[model samples]
Target chain A: MRAAARPGGKVTIAEVAARAGVSKGSVSLAMNDKPGVSAATREKVLKAARELGWLPNQAARSLSSAATQVSNIGLVIARPARMLGLEPFYMEFVSGIESVLVERSYSLLLRLVHDVDEEIGVLDGWGRSKQISGSIMVDFTVDDPRVAPIAALGLPVIAVGHPDLTGGLPSVWTDDGAAVTEAVRYLAALGHRRLARVGGPATLGHSMIRSEAFAKAVADLNLEPGRILPTDFSGEQGARATRALLASAQRPTAILYDNDIMAVAGLSVATEMGVSVPAELSLLAWDDSQLCRLTHPPLSAMSHDVFAFGAEVTRRLMDLIDHGDAEVGAVPTPVLVPRGTTARAH
Target chain B: MRAAARPGGKVTIAEVAARAGVSKGSVSLAMNDKPGVSAATREKVLKAARELGWLPNQAARSLSSAATQVSNIGLVIARPARMLGLEPFYMEFVSGIESVLVERSYSLLLRLVHDVDEEIGVLDGWGRSKQISGSIMVDFTVDDPRVAPIAALGLPVIAVGHPDLTGGLPSVWTDDGAAVTEAVRYLAALGHRRLARVGGPATLGHSMIRSEAFAKAVADLNLEPGRILPTDFSGEQGARATRALLASAQRPTAILYDNDIMAVAGLSVATEMGVSVPAELSLLAWDDSQLCRLTHPPLSAMSHDVFAFGAEVTRRLMDLIDHGDAEVGAVPTPVLVPRGTTARAH
Candidate 1:
């Protein structure tokens, strides 16, 4: 049984050390499970700590000599801050990550960088100073420059991208390629002969994967060759791409967007051009958010629980930090949630 | 003239010490402008550092003995993770804070707590550990428990709320009462006599201020006493409130929502209930974001630039950290932005 009460108010390490008949240093070593303390001494110290109801605050734990006891976890995102705020994915993902972290009393050290090189510098600085116990790296690009440098730092990290792109680092990923294929096939089954895609920047690993999957699916189904427009994943870019696609004499009947914001922008463009949704043009969005439900014709999307995905990633990161290794992890693939936007071609 | 190239390689504190003919500890003291270093030694260290083109990394600065030289700023928010992700206000504000922080190469140490007592514990722990040099406090309530404990800690802080609520802490705020008065007068001018408000939690200081202003505006305009419904600022709560009001025997002809998300949800509820916007009912939203413009018949709002407000708050915080005090600052008040949601009542 645990101690019911403390005799002299709050417990401290000094009291625990005195009770254990050990020095303060030995108590710290025993509590952190470091190698310097003998097994018997560690047990005695622990028993004393238990009886005294002594628990280290997060700051004390972080400041301890053991390198793995840090309270801060770093997350570096290479995106403009302005764009990041508008995107629901990161906010939801962060909140999800926070859900698990609060239990452990760890803080998230968040930074936004301009590019991979800057991200590398930030990670290197963090590692050298022992500022963070582990990190989460995101936005992997094709043949990413950050992978090799980050691996060299030997920091515990969970890369959020496909295994092929993460360069052997432990990762948590979603099956974006499979999700894209499913979306294409679903649209085709609805008798959409011509399909087009408004994708994120072509350099992004997931975007490249989706583009290749889309091509393979279209060819496999014997549908008309589709057009793909790469964009910066902004609402303005999404609107511009939609305008260009709709202006074509032989426009596709159905369109898919890489994110919900782009799809919403595309919908506005269609309405401004006097094209009714589903009846004249069909739209599908990815990474469904509350914005989708608030729209007039709630968007059909390739929906996965992004919040859960973030929580999963954080769990993997914590495991990696504690054990020095973690198995590759995967979240559920995005599944099509057909709302009012998709219909059979006339 | 600055050094054109390093003689051997990267500049280190050791090299600066060697060049200045001083010990490494003296070099640190001089660089950080600590009291131990003499004027002559400080001059020599500065000259040598400039010649070598040496700059300290963020981690190195944080590890320095000087109490004012930390590179991390803490922000503790007391809200549920799920609600925070959907609000849009905090995310946009954080991004804006980040925009300025990135320029100084500082990191934002963000935490979400369950209540003010937990927040105080977190801040106290952060102070004890020297984890942060300064902080930004948000979401003040009447008779806030945090103000005294935080003031006693003596950490430089910039509270983000009205001066009346912040309890002598340096602050950055917007005039929510004035903004509420403006919204009410605008609606009254548009011939809306049966006005109502869907506000945030009544316990919040700003919400209380807005509620009082709203009541005063109705009485001053010689209109019927209006109704106020308090919510947790979720889209679901907004929808429920809208439904309850619409179902009343004498429903409001116009409604003003505390946030854009609720306004959007209210619009959907109106459509579902067969109430026509601007013809049968009018709505106004606050804290305008991209979500406001994306909806059908786009929402008119009491708009303020949340991003700029965040940046301004950060600037004031930096000033407090460096100078031990800052002037009470205010951002531009929310202004009326006319869109398709509001019109003269029939």
Candidate 2:
């Protein structure tokens, strides 16, 4: 099934054997460089493999033979280079991955791409060239194009996304939909009638899940739907979105930001405009970082252990590398942590 | 001189040729994999190279042949993995490096270590195995133990420190001594009789350079040397240092933080303790990030273009990889950008 799902469709050892006019065991023997297969039959099997563009599992290959599989794991992120520096989520995630990697003395091969296509190419090249033993994929979008090419190459990967979006890749994700629902319910319970959400890019799978959950929660509570303004997860964009929302005639009493950096920026916008926080505007940040505590009036956040999440993803990847299969599931639900920023609606 | 300074010291192609009982040109041809070398001569030359632990210039080898040179560059940091998550310096620096690396479509191999010894082992393994084309080295301590092993391996490297501290490796650095002098002069000019600095760890080369410069500046200005507290550059440590300073019977009228996170934490400390910025106390932060701007009364800082510095370091490394040599020099001086945090001493 997985071979069929690859870029050019599923290619199996049986298919290779049939095309080569040899038995499956003979084909395997030829492919594995073992004896009992004639040179001509071996050549036919090799030709069929080349023609079919079949990729054997490098991890499995390394286990059977003395092939020099690089003790490096590739991580390709499609993000603006400037934003990557300031975002606490990525830094924390990378640190978490390193915690596990250091135990095995493995290195991380990090690459930043402008889009998903680039990420796929980079991963495919790494797989074909044997540059890494495994890879961890993050920031999945709807129907991510990276899935097929990666699966086709049979590269061991641990995807950071919901199962629906990962296309059968072993995935680790926080329950974003559940977290969004919780955030909205908490704000509603605080007697806030109108709520707004500052979301990340519309293209991201997690952002889409959060947005849909927000809509559902609003309808379920019979409250006015919060305006969800998509942003690139930069502080400047966060501030701009906050300014626009506040300037509107029917402004929300509370705002939920997708990340802490943007939430901090939104807070700054409120202060700049002389809007009293919690008294008039309640701000909540996601992926609670130390930035929440450092602000003038500390921010309330949707708190989860991102470091632990990263470690969990890395653990799954290591398992995939060693045992050749892993369970895909959500790690944990983010809890609403109350702080100075969020209070009873006045 | 660099050859003599290597670990086993003074290994040369001529010495290798004499040991192999071949001419120097034959040794060169064999090492470079050129057509002029015979099979037996090439074997002897390679054996001699192994016996002497000499590695030919990898960049040259890549240029001449279709060797599977990994399209990756190695970066190893000797720091606690937890701290790396919160530190903006490395993220920004890494972003800058990405700005250049992206253009060439190369991957960055990142690793974190507990100390210099671990860092040395990692780099040695990478060099010996050709896991990377080159590497970037940072955080040089006084008499850094990493230099000799790295140099002996003849791996192309770009050291991120002053030349005096980098042991003959091509380096890219900011003038920390000058930046310290400027910060001190700025504070003294504001009529602050007592000045203190929250510096990074004492073992770091840059920290020592800044400390000595601070002492000289204090003496030249006819003022007593203010206390310098060393920290691990964490916000919590910064807050603790600030609390201790403010609680002292002879508190400093002004304080300088080594980084923006620490300065922001110190600002929070001042507010919580009923101290006023630029009124009863003056605060200055280093490495001005967007965090400096987001605070209530924006922080004044010694600002430098860290992204450009990272880019410059990468450029020099690319040069080193391409040409087998590069020039070492300071990138730029950090300028004092005054904001609300600094004011005249009352």
Badly placed stretches (over 4 Å) of model 2 are A1-69, B1-67
| TM-score of each model, paired residue for residue | 0.82, 0.81
Clashing pairs in 1: none
lDDT at residue B232 of model 1 (Cα atoms) = 97
- TM-score of the B chain in each candidate versus the native B chain: 0.81, 0.80
Q: List the residue pairs that clash in candidate 2.
A: A3-A10, A4-A10
Report the C-alpha lDDT of model 1 over A1-346, residue by residue, as the tens digit. Answer: 1101112336788999999999999998876656999978977886676555455554455554333444888898888888877888888899888887887778888888766655765675666556678898898877786765566556788889998888766777999999999999999999998999999999899899999999999999999999999998888899899999999998999999999988988888888888899898999999987777867678899997887888888888887888776767568899999998898887
Worst 10 residues of 2 chain A by lDDT: A1-10
Model 1: CA > 4 A from native: A1-69, B1-69
Model 2, chain B: what is the TM-score? 0.80
User: Highest TM-score: which candidate?
Assistant: 1
Q: lDDT by residue for model 1 over B303-331, one digit each (tens)? A: 98998888888888887787766767577
